[model samples]
Target: MLPFENIILIDKKSSIAVYKQIANSIINTVRNGVLKPGTKLPGSREMASILNVHRKTVIASYDELEAQGWITVFPRKYVMVAEKLPLLHPKKWDETELAYSYDNDLKINFRIIDKSWCVERDTVEIIIDDGHPDVRLSPIDELLKTYRSFTSRQPAIKSANKGTAQGTVRLREEMVKFLSITRGLTINTDNILITHGAQMSIYLAAQLLLNTQSTIIVGKPNYTVANETFIQTGTQLIEVSVDEYGINTDQIEQLCKKKKITAVYVIPHHHYPTTVTLSVERRMKLLELSNRYSFVIIEDDYDYDYHYASSPYLPLASANHQGNVIYIGSFSKLLDPSLRIGFMAAPKNFIVQCTALRKMIDVGGDGYMQNALAELIKTGELKRHLNKTKKIYHNRRDFLNDLLQSQLSEYISFTVPNGGMAVWITLRKDYSVKQLQNTPLLKIIRTDEESNSFRLGFASMNEQEIEITIDLLHNLLKKQ
Candidate 1:
C-alpha cells in the first residue's frame, strides 16, 4: 500500500482564500489522526487536481502548513507530515472560517503541471560510461597472464614518483614505439607527462597555463566538463564558431589579435558532440595560428583510437615546432575509465612547471594500474582489446543510426560519428528544444545547443535498450 492513502482532495472554489481552505482541510485531517507521521503527502499536481485549482495554490498552502510546523516539504520530490508538531485543530469547519475567507479575498487555484512521468537523473547524462571499451573485449586472459607474470617475478616495486613525470621509462618507451609506428608522432618520454585522465591532464594544463587573467578559447558547443572546469578556475571563456571544415581558423586569428587568448582547446581527431574531424589543412593552419599568436594549443585527442570511417587526423602536437602545442592522449577512453592513466606531450620547456602543477593536483597516479596498463600495451593487449571493443560499439552505433534514419530522420538530422561512443543529432526546426525539454520524461541537459542538439549514449545501452529509448524520444518529440 502507498503512503498518505487517506486525505481526500477537497476542492472548494469560494470567496474564501484557497490556501486557508486547503490548510484547514489538512489541519483537520492531522488533528483527527487521519494523517500520520512519515507519511508523504500528494505532490502539488495530485492535490491541485483534487481541489480543482492551480498546483501553485496548493503549494502555497503546503508552504503555510510547513511554516507553521503542521507539515514538511523536502528538496527532493516529496511533501510529508512534520514530526510531532502541535497545532490548534478543529474536527469540523467553524463559522469563523467563512468570515476569514471573506476578509482574505481568496479566489481560485491554478492547474498542476504533470511532472510525475520523468526520472530526474536523465536530466543530465555522462558522456563516457563504465561499460565502453568492453573490458571483456580486451584479452583478459593475456592481461591476467602478464599480471601473473609480473606478480610471480617479485621484482622491486618502484614508487609512483620514482621516474620522470612523463611516466616510468618502460611505459613511455612503449608509448613512443606505439605512436611512432601508428600515428607518426615522434615523442620521447621527456616530452610526455603521465596523467590520470586526459581531462585531468587538461585541467592541469589549465591550472599551470591559465589563471584569472588568462582567456581560453574553445569551440562553440564545447565539452561540458571542460567548460565547467574553466568556469571554476575563473578563466575567461571565448567561444569560436566552427564550420563544416572544423574550427574556423580565420575567426581564431581575429580573436588572437583582439583578445588576450592564452590557450586553445580542440578535439582534432573526432570533435566532441559534433563528430566533424579537423581537416588536415585546417590543422596546419591552426598550428600556424598558435605559433603566430604566441599561445599554446590544447589538442584533446579524444576517441582517436576508434576511427571507423576516415583515417584519424595527425594530432596538433605532432606538428609542434614552436614548442607551443600541448598534445593530450588517454587510454582510459578505450581501455577503461577506472584506469585513470593518460599522457600529455608538451614542449620540453613546460614539463617541469606542468609536473609541479600535476604533483600539486594528484601527486602521482596508481602504480599498480599504471604498471598493469603498461604491461597491457607492452604485450599488445591494449590495441588488440581496443579493436574488439570498437567493433562492438560500432555495431551499436550503426543500429542506433539505422533506427533514427528509418523512423526519426523525418524529424531529426544526425550523422554517424567516424569515431567515439556518442552520436551528434540535430532536431528538426519544426520542434523547439524548449518544448521537448518541458515535456514529460524528457531527460536531457539544458541540452548541448540552444538549438535542438542531443547526444545519444550508445556505449552503455544494448540494441534493445537503444531501440526503446529511440521509441520513447520519438513519442515525446511527436507530442511536441
Candidate 2:
C-alpha cells in the first residue's frame, strides 16, 4: 500500500538500526500526509514481505511507532496512524522556490534601536588601518605549540571547560607579575578581569559607572568608539581641547569646578589620532583632580607597547590614585587584532562587579588562548616578541616619517611622535584630506576635514611598503 517498499529505503551500513529507520520513515510519511490519521498500516509480516526484510525487523518498527504514539496497535488487529494527531498542513514543494535560506531582508515585527552609531566595514584588500600591529611578526608558532600542549592533556581540557567568567587562573596570576614589571601597577589577580578586548573593557566600565544623570569628560577628538560607548549610556559627555601636550587638564579642572564629574576617560600615552603624550605635570594634575572631585578615571592604555621614543610614561593607574582608576589594556595590539584578549585592572570590589556583569553577557573567555599567553609570559617568549617587534616598529615609524618629510612635505606637515607607531599629519590648507581618502590605491584610516589632518600608521607596513604608499600619495598630490 502506497509503495511501502519504495518509500521505506534502508542501508545496512548505516549507524541507525534498520528498525528505527523504518519507524522514522513511517512517521515522516504520516507527517507528510501521504498516510492520513486512522489509516491502517499493513501487517508486520506483510510489510516484511513487501520490503524484503526480516519479519522481526518490521515488528520492531511497528512497536517503535506504537511507543512513539505515531501509530495505535491492537492485539490480533491492524496497526493504524494515530487518530488524535496534531494538525500539520503539508507544504507544497516548488521547484522554482528557495525559502528558509540565509536572506538578510528580514521582516521583523519588533522595533530595533537606531544603529547609526555603529561604524560600517568596507571590504578592501589593502587599507591603512589605524595603527595596527604587523601580524607577520606575531609569535604564532610558539602560541600554537602551547595551544596544542593544552589540547593534548586531560587536566588542561578540564581547566578550559571549567568556565570562569573572570578568566583562567594561570593568566590572571601571570598578568599580576607582567603588569607589575611592565607598567609599575601594584595589582593582584583579584583586581584583574580578562575581557574579549579593550573595547569590551571600555563598554563595561561605561555601563557600570555612567547613567543619564552622570557626566563623563573626554578629549575633544577622543577615541571614537569610547566616545560612542559613553554616549550610548545616556551620559553627558563633556569634551575638552586636546593640544600638543594632550588633553587640556586645566580645562578639565575648570569643568570639574563648575559641575560634578562622574568619570574621566583619558588616553595619556600616545593619545588617539593626535599621537601626543600627556605632559607629566598634567598627569599629576589629572590624578589630583580625580582625587579632589571624587570621580572615576578610566585609563585606556591601548598600544602602550609600541612607544618608539624614550621610556614611555607610566599609566595613571600605576600611580597611587586611591582606587579611583580603572586601567584597560589589550593584547590585540601586542599580537593580532583578531586574537581579542584584553584585561581590566581596578579595585577588587570593582572587578568582582565587572566579572558578574561580564557573566550576564558572556559566561567565560577562551581559556586555551589565555593559558597559552600565560605560558609565553612565564617562558619570556611574550617579552622577547615585544622587544623584537618594538625595534622593527620604531624603525618603520622613523622611515615613514622621513618619506613623508622628503616626498610630501609640500602638501602635508606632521609631528614625528616620540613613542607611538603613527604620525599625526596636518594637511595643507590648499589640499583637502578628502583627496587622500578618494585615492584608489590608498585608504586613509582617519581624517579630520575641519582640522585638515589625518593619522598615518606605519607599524603594520615594512619600509618598502611604506615607500610605495608614500609614492602613491606623492603622485596623487601632484595630480591634485
Candidate 3:
C-alpha cells in the first residue's frame, strides 16, 4: 500500500476540515505525479491509524475522492484510482480536432516600445556598469543578523500582518529621523510613502500627476527608464538641454510660458547619466517657477548617500517652502540593488493619494525587511556601513581618475565627478561608440548616443580590473 502518512498532512487548527485536507493532499499527490494512477492506498482503518484521525474521517476522505472521480470503489472490497484520470491540457479541444494557429489569427494592437537602451553584455567577463555600487562592500552579514532577530520575535512577525501600505511604522519613523539628520529635511511620517524601489516611486508619481495630453519637462539625456515610465502614462515629454551645471531651468521657464506644464522631473543631485549637480541659482529659480506656474517637481535623488568629494548639495525637497516637490530616493545604491528599499516624500495629501494607489498595485513592502532596516538605523549600523564604504569608493574614484588621465586622455575627455559613483567620459569626435565596439574587449561598456559619452562605473571594479579596462581602451583608441 502507498504511504499515506508521508503524502497527507492534516492541519488540526486550519479552517479547512481535516477530511477535506486529506482529500486535497491526495489529489495534489496524484496531480504532481507522486502517486501514479492505479497505485493502492491503505484501508480506512490503516490510514486512520497512520494519520492519527478517526476511521470515519478517513472513510469520508475516501468517499469524497470517489465522488470527485479521483478513485473507484468496489462493493465491500477494494478502492482504486479511476482508469480515466483528469489531465490538464493547454486547450480542451477533442483529440481529433485540428490545432488552432494563433499566429495567423491574432494581430497585436499595442505599440512595441524599443528597449535598445539595455545593453546585453553577459558574455563579456569584464563589465563597466552604469554607476552601480560594489555589492562586496555591503554589510550583508549584519543585515541578515538583524533579519534573523526580527523573525525570532513572535510579536514582530505578528505585527507585520498589520503593516500599512505606506510602510511599517517603525521604518517610516526611522526614515523621518534619518532624513532630518542627514539631508536637513524636517518631515513627519505622514509625508512619506515607502516603495519597492525608486522606479516604482517614479511610476506612482507619473500615474497620479499625469493624464493624457499632459506635458512634463525633462532633461534631453535623462534616465531612460524614468523617461519610459512617463511616456507610458501618455504624457508628452519636453526635453531641455543639460550642461555641466545640469538641466536648463531657463528652458523649463520658456516651456512654462508657452504651455501649462503639468510637472518637471529632475535629478538635482548628481544627475543621472551625466553626473552634474544642478546649480544653486538654477535650483532656487526652479522652485520659484514651481510656485508661480503651480507645477509639481519630481526630484529623483537616487545616489544621495554615495557622495565622495565635498558635501553634496541638499535636495530640492529639503528647501521647498512651496510644497510642490515630490522627492524620491533609494538605498539600493548604498547597499545592494537586490535590497529594494526606496521612499517618496511629498505633501501629506499627495502621499495619501500615492499610498492609496500603491495599495492597488502592491499592498505593502516587505515588512520584515523594513523592520530589520529600521533596527539597523536605530543601532547606528547603517550609518557606520555608509561611512566605511564611502572611504573605499572615494579611493576607487581617485584611482579611476588617475588611470584615465594617464592612459586614455588622448582618446576621451571626462570630468572627475565630485560626489557620484560614475565618471562621465565624452569620446573624441573621431572615435565613435561604433568604432570603440570594433575592439574585441572594449565593447562591453555602454555608451550614450545623445552626448557621445560613456558612463564607466568604477566602484564595483577592483584595482586589477580597472587597470585592465583602461589599458584595453587606450590600446584600442591608439589603433584607430
Candidate 4:
C-alpha cells in the first residue's frame, strides 16, 4: 500500500511564496506516484480545515492550477484530475506554422528536437539551428533502402489490442543492449519500458513515485522542459541551489527533514545549461541521502554520448548502490532529435509501478519509430552513426569556442562541456543577455527563469553557418 499522503499545509517558514508552495505540493502528490492519477482531492473547505489555512488560500491555490491546466473544477465542490497526458519527443515545431510565420531571415531547423516548451515564445517555432549533427554521418541511404526493401512488412508492432504498454519487444531488446554499453546499466527487455523521449521518461518516473503534496526537488533554474514536465504531472518543483560538485546535498537533508520530499531531480552528469559535472564523491553522497530521506534521484544523462573530455565520469545511476536512481536519457542529443527514443533505468522493483503509470497515460510508444530504432541498434547503424557524428560535434564545439573567443571574447563567456551538443553560454554581464532577447535575430518562446543564459546548439550547425552566425551575434553583443 502507498504511504500516508495528506492535505498540504504551508508553514510560515516556507520560503516558497505560499501559493506556489501549496500548488506545487499538490502537484508533487499527484506526480510522484502518491495520489493515484484520477483520485479526487478534498474540497477547498475540507482542505483548509485540515491544513489550518483559510478557505480563500486553498481556493486561490486551486485557481492557479486550474489556469495552468492541472485540475478541473465543477461549479460547486467537485474537483477531479484531468486525464493523464503523454509528452512526445520535442517535435512541437510544425512546418505549417513555420511556412506561415514569414520570418525568412530567422529560419531555424531541427538539427535536434523534442518537448522543450520553454522557448521564449508560446508558439513553438522551428528554431533555426547551426549545430545539428551531420545526418550524413548515418547510413541514411542504406537504412531507407533497407526500409523499402523489407519484403514482408509484418505489422511493425504486435501487442496492440492489449494496450501496447510494455513497448515493442524488438525495441526493448535493442535498448537493453545500448544501455549496457553506454551507461554501464544492465536490464533485459522486461526492465526497460520505451517512451517517446526522455521528457516522457522523467514524467513517467514522477507519475510512479510521487503523489499530490509530496515534495519534489530539482536544481534551481533547472532545464525548463523537465521543470514543466514535473509541474504538468502535478509535481511541485522545489529548486535547490547547485554548485560545481552538484546540488547542495546539505540542503537536501534539511528540506527532507522539513517536508516529505518524494523525489529529487538532478542532471549530475554534465547538467543542463550550466554544464557542471557532479563529482563522484557527491554522486555517492546523494545516493546516501536518498536512502536516508526516502526520496528518489532522477539522473538526466542527456549528453553522455558526445564526451569531448577523456574518460567522462560514469552516471549517477552507475554509482547508485541503494538502487534509488531513476536514470533518464535521450538519443536526440547524440544522433537525431526527431527520432526521440529515450528510456529510463530504474530498480527492478519500481519498473512495474512506472509501467503502470505509463500504461495509463500512453499505452505504448509509437510503433514505427520504435521498430525502426530497434533495427538501427540491432544492425549497428546507431552506434556507427554516433561514433562518426561525435567527431563532427567535437569539431563544431571547437569551432564555436574559437569563434566566441575570437569575436565575442570581451563581451560574453560560455562553459565548454567536455562533450555535449550545445554550449551553455552565460553572459559575463546579465543586461547584455536580456537586451539580445529584443532582436529579431533572437527568438524567445516559453522562456521563464532561463533568461540569464542562452543555449547555443553547436552540434546542429555547419562550420560556415556557425562562423557567420557567430559573427552576426558578435556584432549584436557589441551593440547591446
TM per candidate comes to 0.69, 0.78, 0.78, 0.69
364-430, model 2: which lDDT tens digit per residue?
A: 9999989999999999999999999999998898788788889999998888888867778887888
Give the range where candidate 4 is weakest over 10 consecutive residues by summed lDDT: 95-104
What would the per-residue lDDT of candidate 4 be over residues 1-480, giving only the tens digit for each residue?
A: 222124465667967777677788877666544566566777888777667778898899889877766678886868766566233236556633232234345566644344545344533323434234556565666555655544245553243223346677777778888888887875677677677778888877876666667768988757777776677656677888877677788888888888888888898877776667887777777888888877888889877887877878878777636777788887766556676678777776677777887877777776655666678888888788888888878888898898888888777666677777777666665446557656766553322234466767777778887877787777777776
Worst 10 residues of 2 by lDDT: 95-104
Candidate 4, which segments miss by more than 4 Å at Cα? 1-136, 149-151, 155-163, 444-451
Q: Give the alpha carbon lDDT tens digit for every residue of 1-480 in model 3.
A: 666787798889999999999999988887766677787677788789999999999899999999888887776677777777865556556554332333253476867776776656555545667788889988788888888887889998886656558989999999999999999887999998989999999999999999797999999688989998899899999899999999999999989999999999999899888899999999999999999999999999999988876888888889956888999999899888889999999989999999999999899988888888888899999899999988988998999999999888888999999887898889889887677764546554557875678788988887887898888778777887
TM-score for candidate 2: 0.78
In model 3, the clashing pairs are none
Cα error, candidate 4, residue 374 (Å)? 1.9
How many pairs of residues collide in model 1? 4
